[model samples]
Target: MADVYDTTYGQADYFGSEASPLLARYADWIPAEARVLDIGAGQGRNSLPLARRGCRVTALEPSGVGRAAIKAQAAEAGLDLDIVGENFMSYEPRGVFDVILCFGLVQILRYQECASLVTRLHQWLRSGGTLFLTAWHVGDPSFARLTREWERLGIRSFRSPDGSQYRLFLEDGEILKLFFRWQTIHHCEGLGPEHRHGDGPPERHGEIEVVLTRP
Candidate 1:
């Protein structure tokens, strides 16, 4: 999986350079010196922007290529970011964070792994900390296609024919169940903005977006 992303990051802008719009949508809640953890922080898209805002950011990316890009960009911009070239499973966090960003991550894991990560998130966040997450859901247009072409691993999990890709699409409000104790700051589900990747034509995902805060 790491190699796959390393190749992708080396070859193209798999995820565009722009930061996620969620940042602007919830800017008031994140302080300038807030400690941030950007899980799966691919190529520093969100990490760089948060750092530029004077937030203390820890960008975790398993792909070496992605980490290098982040380091280069941060150095060029004279920003100091804590870049971790470790996947979530192997990396152990040192302290609690004021904010955690999980973008384009959940779908790649199985149900149990995703749930486990959610448990860890609760423990890793400071009281009143915020979490921003996004994932593809079962209602996605691609889900039907993937169900037909791929091997079903679970109720919502699928593996591609070549076995190079795996996905676990969420059920509507499925993630909310995991964080039921938290306060919901924002929640939306449906098709996401159009995007193009690696010579592929424009496409949009059936995405679930949520922002929550621990009590």
Candidate 2:
């Protein structure tokens, strides 16, 4: 995965050059000088902007090349960010945070893995902290094929262009079940245009975006 991300598609291009729309929309919810954790923080899309806004940002990424890109970008911008090159599922948090961003990552995990991670995330958040989650869903046009493949092979994944298997889609109800303990601030499910990460053509997909706060 690291090699694939590094060579085929840079994290920056996968997420684009700007902060995600979800991050930009909920910027006000993150307090200035708050401690923030960005799980699967590919190429510092949210990390860089949040750090610039006076938040203490810690970006956790599994890819070395991605982490290096994040560090380089931070240095170039003269921003101080804690870049941890580790998978979010195995990486332990040193302390609770004021905010946690989990964009473009949750759907990558198996059902049980995502459930376990969300449980940990709830515990990792400080009181009144928020969690921003975005994931691919079953409404996607490619989902039917992926589901058929999974059922036939007993594996929930689709083949990537690199010949590697990638995670399949999720349902909106399933996503809600994982974070049921938190107070939802916003929740929406809809279709979105697919933007090619590298050389592939665009393929449309369904997505769910949610913001939940710990009481």
The TM-scores, one per candidate, come to 0.95, 0.88
Q: Candidate 1, overall lDDT? A: 0.89
After superposing candidate 1 on the true structure, give the runs of residues whose Cα lies further than 4 Å from its correct spot: none
The model with the greatest TM-score is: 1
Assess each prediction's global lDDT (C-alpha) against the native.
0.89, 0.79
Residue range 59-174, candidate 2, lDDT tens digits? 99877777888899899989999999777768888899999999888666655677677788878998889999898877877777766554322244454444454665666666
Q: Write the per-residue lDDT of candidate 1 for residues 93-178, one digit (tens) a residue.
A: 99999999999999988777887888889888998999999999888889998889999999899888898888989888888898
Question: Could you tell me the TM-score of candidate 2?
Answer: 0.88
Question: What's the CA RMSD for each of the models?
Answer: 1.4, 2.6
